[model samples]
Target: MKSIDTEKINVGVVGLGLMGTSLIVSLLIAGHKVKAIAPIPEDMEDAPQRIREHLMICEDAGTLDRPVDCYLSQLVISEDYLLLAPCDLVLECVIEIPEIKRSVYKKVEAIISTDAILASNTSAIPISELQKGLFAPQRFLGIHWAEPSYFTRFMEITCGAQTDAVLAEWVYELAHQWGKEPTLLRKDIRGFVTNRLMYAVYREGLSIVAKGDATFEDVDKAFRYDVGSWITLMGIFRRLDYLGLKDAFETYNRLAPHFCNDEQIPPLMQNMVEKNAKGTRNCLGLYSYTPDEAKRWDEAFAAFNVDIYRLAAMYPSQREKKKTRV
Candidate 1:
């Protein structure tokens, strides 16, 4: 296999929405040339400014080593798919509808080289399902990322039924260049690793609230104060080991029967959706927020991300520590 030169990589991002624009900054910070294609007119108009603002925040947080312009100069934001002809990798971050995503894939495949890898930023869709009808299905995979992509280290690289394993491993190496702790899933599954674990927690949390065992605020505090405290330093498996797994093993056996096994969506979430509550975007979430309060919360979350990024950096992964020793 040919080695990828990280410095010279030209990445194209389709769909210049929130995650798409944020992802460009990440690629730019890692010293890659980026071509951003906004499929919609609104995204084309808003993406540049949003990207600039995100970079400024990164600069303020000392994450961006050079001036924002230095990074901005590496970016080319447009509505033209032809501009993606030179991109070594292209990420599709459009809406989650299968039809919409497949349409974007058709246009992208027409432009990029056969060797160029095509990936999706899908959080819920199965990678194999999306790989269907693609001209080069072997080169297609899922490259899921968390929000505020530049600040977060989480990335999931998943392989579909037809995805080439060697190519998937290449993306694993590439993700490391982007400063991500990427997990490569050899087999495709809905929600992959992170979402599967998170959704389980959500199901249990919602079940408790619906059963009147605890209020949503109560559940939030437990998660924020308990799980939030040590999760950054150690994931769940490590936490179990740290606490002595014997007790955990016993507790799990005892509580297994009581766990929520509901297959249906929780009523709490259904009701919220019915009411058109879009959280901070509309200031109508589980907890009441005035317009001012909602804006403040949004600002606070962004600032908190920066702080958490710095904090997480202080504790490098075991893999990094092993490298340091070597």
Candidate 2:
């Protein structure tokens, strides 16, 4: 088996949903050869076009330096699992079903080299649970990526009970090459870090609305205007420090008891799910939208992502600091 080369490695992605194709673009941009496996027939038919469109968006956003074809040429999309034989790393972005994921893992493991790493892009599944039955459980881990992988700098590299620490560290470092600010979670936990934090906010937001303290629109405005203002520049902890720890301490003490602690799913969300509401995708959501309104919201979000991607680059997490006086 060939050794893993951070500069020019062969990476394979199994599953070709929107996130999978977007991730292929990120890998290609990072100068790696990518093999994408479309497990479902529908994805197989749509993967190539979806990839092309994402690359085109990158070009328009001025994120793609070379001709789009240059990157696309380095990708191979197929149903053949054998093509993954040369991959140094393979990440599965399939459904969150454990059975389906385990089956894909079995197939990929049968073809790839022993040294090759296998990972999943599961958002909420515990990495420890997913690695339970894998042939080489030590090599299996979780590498969660935010949507629009090429644009977002968010990534989380998680370790299961049997994960090789050294291998996970290598991936954590390599994630920087893919333009991510990756967090390494040495211990596995359900919902990982991002989901836990975001879901807490979601629960509180939903509860507030359900209790008549605020409407959905009111919560959305507060989140967008307040949290959205400084969240990009500084995360929760840092913002607390930036504002003043004393104020945060006092607020937390006063508000802790009143915050939502409901263990059950929020009724508003449950109702929406029961109605098959997919937000902007189907013009049905917390707030109703006409078909054209939904389309506009969808387009606006894509454009916003591009703008924010560029803006965030200006204040990167690793920005070099100026020397201070002794």
Candidate 3:
């Protein structure tokens, strides 16, 4: 992949909610000029303030180099779509509704330059489905960023059937330039890579709890203590290869029955959704917690991610490369 000329590139992020705010922070820290756009009038007022907050959090955690104010100066927030014309890359992070996404994309397509790459942050929508009504489908793709996009380096770059390969490759390279560890999806698949693997585990986990095989805490403990640490460094495939592929596959085939089958949605999850019990936001879901408790959980999640990134940075090859680059 060819390197993006960081000095010449301007990134525009649409949607100033949690994910969009995080992306702006990441781009600012990577030394890129960023323009953030939000539909709500209040977001135009709060974008820079929120960006400053994120920078302060990073600085407090010792992950950033300078003051929050310094980074805030690099971000520009606008309510008009025309302000995005100068952006070389525009990432759409609106809510997951199809009509809402399409409406936003239409506005973005009108304002952005013909050469600008348009990407969606949708987790569940297929890239092809999103590209269907677009005039220039080749310039559009999916950039699946995990939650809290600032600190987490994993980025999945997926392309629709109509997406240009060269453009996809350019986006992949640009992600690295912005300090992301990006993986390219050669073909668009439902749920993408990370979600597919995670949902498989989640299905079984929910099933286990539903069947009274184990409590939620017990199931979480099995993964948190055993698989979590190892999987951080080595992925599932690599870990299996290290353990001898033949033996691993044989064991999986035999023990697979003990795991949950491809069954209907667990009753508990359906009930929660029906009641509008959306985890911490609604203060009730699989677990119940107060607003303060939810805030603590968010902090713990951020800190855990920070530690994971630090460990990833410590890879032997990465260490040597850092020295050589210096």
Candidate 4:
């Protein structure tokens, strides 16, 4: 009913992990008042410090002119759901478990206003399935964000079958105000857009290494040097268009059946998990890393996100041309 453009509506975030905290910082930077719920004593204890670190990152990037405390003043980390009754939008960012997310939605729906739009930052779950057993399914949609939400300009607003189209548009415009390159998906689908494409790459890359066709570094080297050079500017289809080559079509015909399309989890990844090789968080994953190197990679990626976000802003992705009938 009201204009979302240039509006500073109250927003509520249900989780306080890295993604949730990063999202809260992004909202604060976009001039919205936010109520964030960490839901656990440990998370609540760390939320303030985590947010302060991000605020300082923004300060150094020259995006936020005010001191960290100035933005901190706008955020409320609360344990109560009643505090969220006034929000215009509420996003659930719980872990990727269905039961945990369903319980959160039920609790959040009970206290919020009927008109408040409910959204999920779910990367893999289907919004249509998540809307089951909700009183007002029309208000629920998926608002998937790329990690380090404060830095990444990408946002996906996906609408389930029951979602209200008008509410989805309001959120779409709001994402633009927050400095995001937002997309609206009219239909709900698993993994939405980005995750689906990215996971395909993951599956193929892992298969290559597991089959001993290449080492982890070799795969990374090829991707970084080849795909990396133009991915930030244009996607694969556009690159193919510019090159006047359809080499991939013939290559795919030869390789389609050979590609890994197994329904079961790869033994490679399962063994890694069984061994507790959990990547930088645990200092080992697909590739081995010393503790110090792991820490450096983590910090370096965070730093790179800030600058890469700026560069992405400078050259945002373009929408594809719609094919017209002859």
Candidate 5:
């Protein structure tokens, strides 16, 4: 119920996969004492090495102030849930399965202090659904982080119906301290805001490809050269307001497809998943590309973020106005 002093807070990340590791390094970079946990003993053993690699990347990107080892020393990796007892905030980033998440939360509840806030990094599951059956559900919420979390400034903070307002505000303030532009969702909503808008674009993009209306390259190029650059700075809604809301609404009504229903997953996407073309992980998707190509795409995305941040910094009034409107 009280605001957390992030500098003094003990943070625990309860998964050692990509997301969990990213959170660990980002929290450490922000000067928080981090306790990182993994389910497997091997994962615990690899944590230090992974942390070092992440720090090296940060150094290469010119984002680190101290030596990697000095930062690594602040992170404590373990396989036992009991090690998280002292943490004031525990972020769960396990597999997306509801049962797995619930099991992790139950374990965390048994170990962490009574007032410790519980958060999930789930992108789709509702926070309320995840908090179901918990004795102190008000402390449970979602702190969804975008992929490559350490590099992305986008963060969505959602609170369940039972979540305390004071705690939500505390988390919002804490996220700002951690160098994230965190947006608080006043109520639990499916996909929150970012994903709701993003997935709408994604679903339509896939539909376009499925209907043979555009090639993958064409769609990528359209976003990259067109709306992508603008959205990076002013987001969709702000850009709409900037361009005149009436004009934006007219365009949306004119171009929005009426038949892009969610009744079925596109055959192309289904086939890709069925064929084990799991995207960057497997180096396959709507279009085939090498691992290096994927890396290039990632670097481009990071560069875009940095450029937008710099531009936004120059226009502080616009950024402040957007915050005020929110």
Candidate 6:
């Protein structure tokens, strides 16, 4: 397939939740004409206002380069799939149900061009399965984004079993243009890379709490002080290399067996779900807080992540440093 060579491409985003909205805004910030579609009419109506508020946030944060109305002018919000017909790319950011995603993909495929890039924002779903029944599966791949996508630099680009290599590479280059430090997975894998690594870390962290070795607060503190210190500078393996890989190997050999090996959902999470615990959103979860306090904490976290994003930029990873020099 030929590469998407245009400086600005027409893109469509299906399922206009926070993710879809953030994506459209980010794409608009990068000068793309976006067609955003949400299932409900009310959500479509509010999408523009939500984007405007986000643009204001970006303006205050000094990230906005152009006027907010410019982005809104480039964006078209609708409930109809036909509006996506002119798109050069379409991203499916719907709920994480296989059948639901397949239905959306089928509908999107019917409306968009045969060669238009079709991507998913799935975190755990395997793209190989998501490509089933597509009119052109070769154009389908996974393009996962993290929360608050417009601000974060993390993106994961994955290829399905039948995905075209050239198209996948094209997406990789496009990701860089989107101002992302995206990892392109050569093979489609369940959980891809981020989720797998994060879950591994979660398993161990939860195991510690379950075993009563530490409280949840202690775990959070440990992460905030320990991993937070250098995670922006280098990843786990790179940090190991900095310390001494042989020493890390020895430590892993001694400690890996003790890490959580349970396949079943831990009671800590299951019980929380049963209780309808939703952290700050519902004022319940690992730690309880007053509603107003919880709201502040949530806002604090949102602002803190932005500041951390800046720190991550300043302490660019070794690869980033080398790339800049070259």
Cα TM-score per model: 0.95, 0.94, 0.91, 0.91, 0.89, 0.94
* Model 4 alpha-carbon miss at residue 322, Å: 12
Best by lDDT: 1
lDDT of 6 at 296: 93
Residue pairs with backbone atoms closer than 3 Å in model 1 (clashes): none
Candidates by lDDT, descending order: 1, 2, 4, 6, 3, 5
Q: Which ten residues in a row have the lowest lDDT in candidate 1?
A: 314-323
* lDDT (C-alpha, whole model) for all candidates: 0.91, 0.90, 0.84, 0.86, 0.83, 0.85
Candidate 6 residue-wise lDDT, 1-326, digit = tens: 44444435888999987888888778888888888888767787787788888788887888878888977888888889999999888999988889888888888988998879999999868888888778999999999988787789899999999999888888877877676888889899778997888888888888889989999999999888998888777887789979988988898899977878888888898999999999888888889989999989979988987897787777655446657897
Determine the backbone clash count of candidate 4.
0
How many clashes does each candidate structure show, in the order listed? 0, 0, 0, 0, 0, 0
Please give the lDDT score at residue 143 for candidate 1. Answer: 95
Q: Kindly give the stretch of ten consecutive residues in candidate 6 with the minimal lDDT sum.
A: 1-10
Structure candidate 2, residue pairs in collision:
none
Q: For candidate 4, list the clashing residue pairs, or say none.
A: none
- Candidate closer to the true structure by lDDT (higher is better), 1 or 3: 1
Task: Note each model's CA RMSD in angstroms.
Answer: 1.7, 2.7, 3.0, 3.0, 2.6, 2.0
Error of 1 at 19 (Å): 1.0
- Residues 1-326 of candidate 4 have per-residue lDDT tens digits of 66774336999999999888989888998888898887777888998899899888888888886778887898888899888988989999989999999999988999999999999999878999999899899999999988787888889999998999999988987887787878899999778888788888788888888889999899899988998889888877888777776787788799988888876777888899899888998887877889999999998998889888888777634432221321
TM-score of 3: 0.91
What tens-digit string does per-residue lDDT give for candidate 2 at 1-326? Answer: 33345546999999999899999999998889999898998888898999999999898888887999999999998899999999999999999899999999999999999999999999868899989988899999999999899889899999999999889988987887898888899999778997888899899999988889999989888889999999999988989989989989999999999999999999999999999998887888999999999888888888888888889888846423321321
Question: Which stretches of candidate 2 lie above 4 Å from their native place?
Answer: 1-7, 319-326
Tally clashing residue pairs in candidate 1: 0
Alpha carbon lDDT at 40, candidate 4: 70
Better of 5 and 6 by TM-score: 6
